[model samples]
Target: MPLEQIRPSHIHQYQNFLEKRELSSTTVRIYLTLIKVICLCINNSSYNLYFSMYSYKR
Candidate 1:
């Protein structure tokens, strides 16, 4: 999917995909954290920090 087409649902789907692969919890956490870090690094978006892992997990 293109960057411009990404939505919250897509993120959820990707998370599900990872789970379906039977990855370890540690691996999943690391991948998700990397994504968050990428987002933070890209825009320095203060608003995003307000929504933490709890928000994403659901």
Candidate 2:
């Protein structure tokens, strides 16, 4: 899906969806951190940053 397709309410809805899946706050933070690190590392590289073990799929 495109980011343009996402709405402000979708952010809250995603949080609720994750909560319903029983993910802990620590896990959530870890995921966010991994996302941040991957983004920071991804500067016009062909490499897949998400190949790291810290990366998770929702």
Candidate 1 lDDT (Cα, whole model)?
0.75
List TM-scores for all candidates, in order. Answer: 0.63, 0.44
Task: Quote model 2's TM-score.
Answer: 0.44
Q: How close is each model in CA RMSD to the real structure?
A: 9.4, 7.3
Model 1, 1-58: lDDT tens per residue? 5555768788788789999999998888888888777766556655565655337562
Q: After superposition, how far is residue 9 of candidate 2 from its true place, in Å?
A: 0.7
Off by over 4 Å in 2: 32-58
lDDT of each: 0.75, 0.63
Return the lDDT, model 1, position 41: 53
The residue-by-residue lDDT of candidate 2 on 1-58, one tens digit each, is 6645656586567667777789998876676566556555664244453455457768
Give, for candidate 1, the lowest lDDT window spanning 10 residues.
Answer: 49-58
